[model samples]
Every structure is written in C-alpha cells, then in structure tokens.
Target chain A: MDYAARNFAAEGYHTTSVTSIVNGLGVGKGVFYWYFASKDELLGEILGDALRSMREAQRDAIAGEPDPARRIDQGIRASLHWLSENRHLFVLMEFARTEERFAPIIRRGDDQMVADALPHVSAGITAGLLRGEDPVFLTMAILGVSGHLARTLVLEQGNDADRVAESVIAFCRQGYLATGTPALARRSA
Target chain B: MDYAARNFAAEGYHTTSVTSIVNGLGVGKGVFYWYFASKDELLGEILGDALRSMREAQRDAIAGEPDPARRIDQGIRASLHWLSENRHLFVLMEFARTEERFAPIIRRGDDQMVADALPHVSAGITAGLLRGEDPVFLTMAILGVSGHLARTLVLEQGNDADRVAESVIAFCRQGYLATGTPALARRSA
Candidate 1:
C-alpha cells in the first residue's frame, strides 16, 4: 500500500498501473492481485486509511485535554503534523476528489472528519468558550482553516508543522471565540 | 468552449476526449485543432476563462465598495454567486487541481485569487477595521472559509447563494475583525 501510495503521489493515479507498482517492488502481478482487487480499490483503501490515521492522530493528541478550546488547538496541530508526515496522501486524496468514482469516498472521508471535530466544537459552545453558533458550520470552518494552512504552509512551503499549527490555532481561536463588538466599535474605543 | 466545459464537468477531464468534444459540438477536428494545440491546451483555456470570469464577477461586485470589510463581504458574495452560477466550472476546476499538468495552472489561479483579496485585507488592517495579522494567511483563510461554505451549502445542499453568502459574510466579519482578546481572556471576562 505504501508502495502504491508513493507511486500515485509521484506519477498520478491514472498513470500509475498495478503492473508498474508491482514492477517497482520487483514482485509478481499475482502478489498484487492476491491482496487487492484492482487499482481503484487499492486507491480507495489508501484514501480511507489516510483519513482514519489523521483522525486517530487528532484524537490521540487531544485526549485528556479538558478544555474544549485547547482540545481544538491540539486537534489542529495534530492534523497538520499528520499531513506533513503523510504528504503523499494529500496528493492522492486531491486526485481522489476529482474522479467520479472516488468523489463519494472522499466526501465520506470529509464528512467523517467534520464529525470528529463536531463534538469538541459543541463542547466549546456549551461551555461558552466559543460563541454560541451552529457547531456544524463552526466545525466545517475549523477544518477549512486547518486544511488551508496545512496545504500552504506545510505542504507547499515546507514550514514546520508546529509553527503552522500555532498560527492556525491563533486565527481559529479568534474566529470561533471573538466577542461580538464590531471592529468599528473597537477602533473608536 | 462552453460545450467542452459542460462535457468536462460532467464526464471529467480524464474521461473527456477531443473527438468526443468535437462530436458533441457537431464540429470538425480541424476546428478544435485550429484553436487548441491539444486537449490539455483546450482544457487549460476553459479553466483559465472560467477563473477570469469569476474574478471579473468579483471585481464588478466590489467595484464601488469603498470600505474594506464591505469589500471582503462583496468578494465572498460575488464568489459564491459566481460558483453557484458556474457550478460546472467548479467541478472542472476541482479536477484540474488533481492533474500534474494542470496543477500549476490552478496554483496560478489560486495565487491570483489570494492576490485579489490581499489588498482589501491590508486596507482593513491599515484602517484599524480589521485585527492586524498576517494578511497573506488571513486572505487564504477567508478564501478557505468561503469555498467550504459554498461547497456544502450551495452546491451540496441546494441552498441559495445569497443565503449562504449572508452566513459567510457574518463569519468572516468576525474572523477578520475580531477584538484582540484570547478565548481564555473572553471566558474569564
């Protein structure tokens, strides 16, 4: 699976054949077919596993952090750290999102990701740490903020995940917990 | 080009062929070949034109809005409005982001988009209408927020663009212009 992932990241899914993947590993086609049904199925497994591992990392990172806002910060940091380590999965998932057959899979993965964050966001709203807003929208917004920062800072710019996480944590803390005073009001004060 | 865009959106770029596109349009191969050197080139043109139109829409929407916060609001609404109108183009652009050949083109379009939002964000910071922060990261965050909302609300949920735009405008107003109080500080206050 790791072999196939690396190839897909480097060569793209359409261009990477099962034969090529096996050839790169100096193995027989039977070895590949024995474990996987086809290239599409294999790619699906990779994408699914990638999402699961990311969720696991975030869950583990935030475990025992009682403060909802702090848990969210830990989640964002773990997500970025995981993405930095599994950068190849990022390319594979991006490709998965484009194809018709893969769209449902990627969408499911995204839905699950949003689900994982939903509870923390809900807790924050309940505890009044975050603004009393719709947790669903806030969860989605939090994921968007983290995903964008991960892509630009860690993947594209090769910045340290911890550093990028700090910036994301700050932005999202402000975004989710801001007092209702308008900028005009604050400026005048 | 319109025909190609529709086909690409529906069938995806990888599944789409020059022959199929020409056949759909009831045109000759020579007509397509004369305008575009290859299918990749044709798709690039379609993608480029779509981006330009969206930018043009945004520019037109925010043309006379003098306030920076209002300008960002106009930009988000304009973007969501354009995305709602050009749903097919959105699919195509998502596909474009996956391909090696198209990644640079999409990146350039994205950079141009960030560039468009940067000036207004900077203006907001300068005018004390927004919290002073890294404009580049803030601009990307704003785009991320708007894009995710548009995808979930307008495209997936069949909500009206204006309705989603209202939600996005409110979220971003607080995101960009929040008072400089940490969540911990607010919680204690």
Candidate 2:
C-alpha cells in the first residue's frame, strides 16, 4: 500500500498502472490480486487509511484536554504535523478529490472529519468560548484554514509544520484584529 | 469556450474529447482548431480566463474602498459571488489542479490572488487593525477560509453565497471567539 501510494502521488493515479507497481516491487500479478481486487479499490483503501490515520492523530492529540478551545488547537497542531509527515498522501488526497470515481471517498472522509470536530466546536460555543456562529460553519472554517495552510506553507513552501500550526491557531482563535485595537474593541462592544 | 468548459465540468476532463465538444456545439473540426490548437490548450485557456475574470470581479468590488479591512471583506464577498455564478469553472479549476501539466496554471493563478490581497493585509496590520502575524500567512488564512467554505457550503451544500460570505467575513474578522468572552479577553491580555 505504501509503495502504491508513493507511486500514485509521484506519478498521477491514472498514469500509474498495476503492472508498474508489481514490476517495481518484483512481485507477480498473483501476489497483487491476492491482496486487492483492482487499482480503483487499492486507491480507495489508500485514501481511507490515510484519513483514518489522520483522525487518529488528531484524537490522540486532544485526548484528556479539558478546554474546548485548546482541544481545537491541539487538533489543528496534530493535523499539520501529520500532514507534513505524510505529504505524499496529502498530494494523493488532493488528486483523488479531482476524480469523480474517487470524490465519494474524499467526501466521506471530509464528512467524518467534520463529525469528529463538531462536538468540540459545539462545546466551545455552549461555553461562550466561541462565537455563536453555526457550529458546522465554524468547524469547516477550521478545516479550511488548516488544510489550505498545510498545503501552501508546509508542503509547498517548505515551512515548518509546527510554526504553521501555531499561525493557524492564532488566526482561528483571535482572527485578524490585533489585541485591544479599536476595531476589535468596537466589535466587542 | 463556454461549451467546452461546461462539458469538461460535467464530464471528466480526460473523458471529454475534442470531438465530442465540437459535435455537441455543431461546429466543424476546422472551427475548433481555428481558435485552440488542442484540447489541452482549450482547457488551459478556460482555466486562465476563469481566474482572470474572478480577479477582475474582486478588483471591481474593492474599488474606491479606503479601509483595507473592508476591502478584504469586499474581496471575499466578490469571490464567493463569482464562484457561485461560475461553479462549472470552479470545478474545472479544481480538476486542473490535479494534472501535472495544468498544475502550473492553477499555482500561478493562486499566487496572483495572494499578491493582490497581500497589500491590503499588510496595510491592515500596519494600521494595527489586524494581527501582526506574517502578512502572507494571514492572506492565505483568508483565502483558505473563503475557498474551502465556498466549495463545501455554496457549491456542494447549496447554501446562499451571500450568507456564506457573511459567515466567512465574520470568522476572518473575529475568529472563533465570542465577544467579551474570557477566552478572548485573556488572549488579548
């Protein structure tokens, strides 16, 4: 699975053939067929495993954290760190999003991510720690910020994932306004 | 261009052949080749034009707005409105990002977008109206929130573009913290 995923991420999914994968590994077609039905199924499994692993990282990061806002922060940090380590999988995920046959897997993973984070968002709002915006939108906003920044900064720009995570948390928690500024003060009023 | 873009968005880009596009439009092969040299060139042009048009909309929306922060808000609203209207092109844009040959076009367009917004973000930070974090990261955070939200909410979930824009701006401005909350107050302190 790792070999196939690296191939898919380096070469386009459609361009990477099963023949090449088996050939590269010096394995017979029988060995490949014994494990997976087809290339499509293999790619699906790759995506599912990647998403599940990412969620696990996030869950582990936030475990035993009592503060809702801090939980969200730990989740963002965990996500960025995982994404940085699994940059190849991240690229594959984006590529999968573009294909129709693969979009369902991506969508399901995204929905699962939102479901996982929704409770903390709700908790924050309930405790008056977060704004009274729709919890789903707020959750989506956090996902958007973390995913996009990880792609642009960590993966593409070679920036440190931990630092980018810090920037993301700061932006998510306090937004653009500086501390005690008139604009922020007025908005708070 | 419009016909081809619609087809590319509906059918997968690779599946939509030049012949099918010409046949659907009731145009001869000569007429198609007269404008574009190849199918790849046609899709490239489509993606380029869509990005250019979107930027123009943002520019027009923010024209004569003196306040940098308000200008950023207008820019986000303009982007959502444009993406909602030209959703087909947006899908095509996402697809274009996946292919190796087409990734440069998307990257260039994204860079142009960041460049356009960087000045305003810098101005806001300089004026103490925005956070003193790296201006580039702040600009990317805004883009990330607006783009991701628009894709999930407006494009997929069928939410109103304007309403989504409001949510985006509110989040970008004040983040996830509620007004006068102890979390926010403590952060400021």
Candidate achieving the largest lDDT: 2
Query: On residues B59-148, what C-alpha lDDT tens digit does candidate 1 reach at each position?
Result: 998998898877888898899999999988988887777677887888898889999989999998887767686888778778877887
Winning model by DockQ: 2
Per-candidate clashes, comma-separated: 0, 0
Off by over 4 Å in 2: A182-189, B29-31, B182-189
lDDT of 2 by residue, A1-189 (tens): 999999988877877889999999999988998999988899999999999999999999999989899899989999999999999899898877766788889989999999999999999999988988799999999999999999889987899999899889988987887767644322110
| Cα RMSD, each candidate | 3.8, 3.0
TM-scores for every candidate against the unseen true structure: 0.91, 0.93
Query: What are the clashing pairs of model 2?
Result: none
Candidate 1 deviant stretches above 4 angstroms = A176-189, B175-182, B185-189
Per-residue lDDT of model 2, residues B32-132, tens digit only: 99999888899999999999999999999999988888899999999999999998998898877767889899999999999999999999989888889
**In order, what lDDT does every prediction score?**
0.80, 0.89
